[model samples]
Target: MKSALMGSLKFQIPQLNFHKTLKKPRPSFLRGRPRPPLWRAKRLSTEAIQAIQSLKLARSSAPRLEEVFNNKLSRLLKADLLDTLAVLQNQNELDLALKVFEFVRKEGWYKPDILLYHAMIQLMGRNKMVEMAEEFFGKLENEGLKPDTRAFTEMIGAYLQVGIIDKAMETYERMKASGCDPDKLTFRILIRNLEDAGKEELVDCIKKECGKEAGGRFFLKISSAQNGKVAVADLQYHVLKCQKARNFAVSSCEADLISTLLKLQSRRAHASR
Candidate 1:
């Protein structure tokens, strides 16, 4: 009965032109081979494409960077303007990005956005204009905007990248005070910076705060059954070997100093007993 019913129900496949489905329509003006792996490629907004072309022309013909942006570009759709700003950012034309940013800011419908402010701060910081970066951050605060974790992280990185450890630490403390929890990337950035600066004591404290051991272990992984438990000396030796192999700026001397301090404190405790 099942075979009879299956025979009675005949399925017909729809005729689809597979070749047509595989082909993409190309504009008559564009003559080039099709780019493969199209899924990863981003399609630019019309305004962004126009902005790129205008920027190129301005670079060749215009004497000043400001000449590229005119009243017409300023009147673009809000989303398109933002897209153009992002394109300028990717192109590393930060000066042009700032000019466009100012124009956008002055518009009647403009509103504050944290990502925009963050990008502005990062751009200034990258140019070594730390003062302007700080000014932008201050402006964000004046706007009554509560900065998110990325904002705090970017500021910390900006300060650290310029060798301003004090400012970085202050920013970090401020982030914590604001109830924003730092993630592993934040911890690693501060840890690596402090390690390079030879601030081993601070690194130890930070590691402890983040629930990591002195050698940066997330959890105590002991192969107890295989090795019948590893000795403290053996563990220290292995950790030092791993550190040397990794070639991290974290020096062996700092680790040794920490071990020496631990031994001294232990002896002192024994004497007090």
Candidate 2:
């Protein structure tokens, strides 16, 4: 009877269909779509490249070169034309670059761009073509554009490149009289070049001017902060930190005053709060 009951209780167990429940692996390409390539500005177009080649090959005669420039290069878009000019300048082809520059200037769409003049001046300076650089600068002024600091700085640099110290100093004075204050860069360039030229007196004068400007600017900020009820200590500390970070030197008197003001302001801020 026991054996018969055991035989009756025996039943078939169903197997699990895991293949139907689990997902199949995807192909490598489908797992994640490939990222698109990054876009970048094209340095030069086909037309520009062709125009440059034509200009270079037409170097036999000025009239023939002018014809090639007019026929091929004049039709390029503004960007392409400027890019071509920049390429010529970088290649140190002074004559070709000047031709392109003059052509660009004559364009109806042309406007006074100080940066363009700056680049040309820099290029001419590198080639020791100080006269050409001066001509370009005169043209810049004739265009009724007030020379900014960079433009003046470039002209000064060009003068200095030819060891024309008097001209450089005159340009610097004109820059100041034009109400374009000399920035740190202007001071730096003047000081460095003057020192190299062994002009000790001029270097001292420049340093004094720089110090006066820095002090006035700093104290102006402090006065403004006081009016705003800002903690003088914090402002002074921040200024000192910035000065140190920028490798600026602070005199002992200035540092002591800053520390004293910082302490006084800290106490005042605490008392008020």
Candidate 3:
């Protein structure tokens, strides 16, 4: 430092002003990192397309599109499709949706999940497909999915809608028989469908199944909707109708005319007397 001061004095020139010269730029800090894409697949699985194609190409007793679901396709199936089927059922597209569902089962990639079964039950009932719904119920049971009140109740309502009271009542019995608690909504729908069909025996059976719980809150709407006609009265009328149906069970009825042998027999009896 002393030598530089001495040299400066010696040099007697102040032209080396490095601080007054140029300056270099500094870099700013960076933040967020990029993320990987979720699903990179471009299209549906080959198995699923084959299944759908097969179903479309099918020739069968049922609609002929059943072959589409010949085998299970885990990658091809989506939860959205199952949910869409549920909505379609409400729109009375049950058979078609069920056709798709059959494919779902046939794909065998996934066991029929609980949600799928429940949706099937709901679809069957909403579309008035009673027997098919019952068949679906049997399938559910066979697959070891426990029936809740909703499952059995939906079946009961469906059977009642089609005037299959015996099946409806049987569904009720089977519900309890299967260890499900019967909810009021089910009974209400049951009573209503039965009453509509005039199936007194079945309605009575439902009431009996309901026992003291017959006076369910749902029944309140049924009563009010009927202008407060009591369920008991309704049930009795249905029973009478069922009996009337039974007394005349023939598909076609023809009364037989009196025979000549009967008249001859009567004449002989009178002469003998």
Candidate 4:
């Protein structure tokens, strides 16, 4: 019986092999899907490369740079524009960068942002163009664009640099009056400057007004949308860490007093979005 079973299985093997040979292949679903170009991953397109090169070449002349920027408007991207701005900044050609910035602003595609404004403020500050920086800051406000805390700090530093301690202190008051609290860098700058100018009383007063000690670090909490519950200690600590890494020196100040905590609260009450 076992020998008969073995004989039957051997007889069916050739038929099974013939059926396997006649079987059809399965269809693929991905055959119609588009594949990304291999070269796109390696580098920018020829047009983009040319546009950036043209931007670098045209930085010497305002009218020429504007012409190139307009010509490449279709092909150029926001990142390309920002890169050109960064290049201009690196070369200490902030005026050129400002020209490009204004040109970009007039473009239909451009939108304002905080970081870009911050960069412009820093550039103007570094160049000792504090008056221009003040004007830019005002323009930013007029455009309904609120400068961030860092921008405020830079403005204060710029005022202090020009020996305009009154303006610096006024900027700080305006900052707190807007419900925006001082960060660690802000405190360090104001305190250092005030102490340097022998205004130890003001330094102590500011520290008492804005900060508290926590975990061996000073913490300043500003009024947020959710009231004053949000603490900026961690953020200030991180800012200090970055400052140390970049060797940012603390700033100083010297000016007359204007408002108290109540005045700042009242200003916050009158604040608009």
Models 1 onward score TM values of 0.58, 0.63, 0.45, 0.55
**Which one wins by TM-score: 3 or 4?**
4
User: CA lDDT, every prediction?
Assistant: 0.64, 0.71, 0.54, 0.63
For residues 1-273, what per-residue lDDT tens digits would candidate 4 score against the true structure?
999999999998887776565657753211122334333444555664576577778878878777887788445676666565655554557766787778667767777677777767767876779988888788788778987788898898777666678888898988888878777567767877777788877787776554231112323344444564664322233223333322221221112111222233344457633
Q: Weakest 10 consecutive residues, lDDT, candidate 4?
A: 249-258
Which of 1 and 2 is the better model by lDDT? Answer: 2
RMSD of each: 17.1, 19.0, 28.9, 20.9
Superior by TM-score: candidate 1 or candidate 4: 1
Angstrom error at residue 7, model 1: 81
Ranking by lDDT: 2, 1, 4, 3
Worst 10 residues of 3 by lDDT: 249-258
Clashes of each: 0, 1, 12, 3
Candidate 2 regions with alpha-carbon error over 4 angstroms: 1-42, 216-273
**Tens-digit lDDT track of model 3 for 1-273:** 999899987675456564475776642111012222212322434554454445345535454442333333233446534543444443445556676677567654558576677668766665577667878888988988887887877777666555677777777877788888776576667766666677778667656555433222221112223566555322111112333222222211111101222333345468679
Q: Give the TM-score of candidate 3.
A: 0.45
Tell me the spans in candidate 1 whose CA falls farther than 4 Å from its real position.
Answer: 1-41, 59-67, 212-273
**TM-score rank order:** 2, 1, 4, 3
Residue 216 error, candidate 2, Å? 6.7
- How far residue 101's Cα lies from its native spot in candidate 3, in Å, is 0.6
lDDT of 1 by residue, 1-273 (tens): 998776655332233433345656753111112223221356767766777678666765555445556644765788777777776665557767877888878878888888898878776766667788888889888877888777887787678667798898899899989998776556766777788899888887666555322334223222334467654432332233343322332332232234433443355468679
Which window of ten consecutive residues has the lowest lDDT sum in model 2?
Answer: 29-38
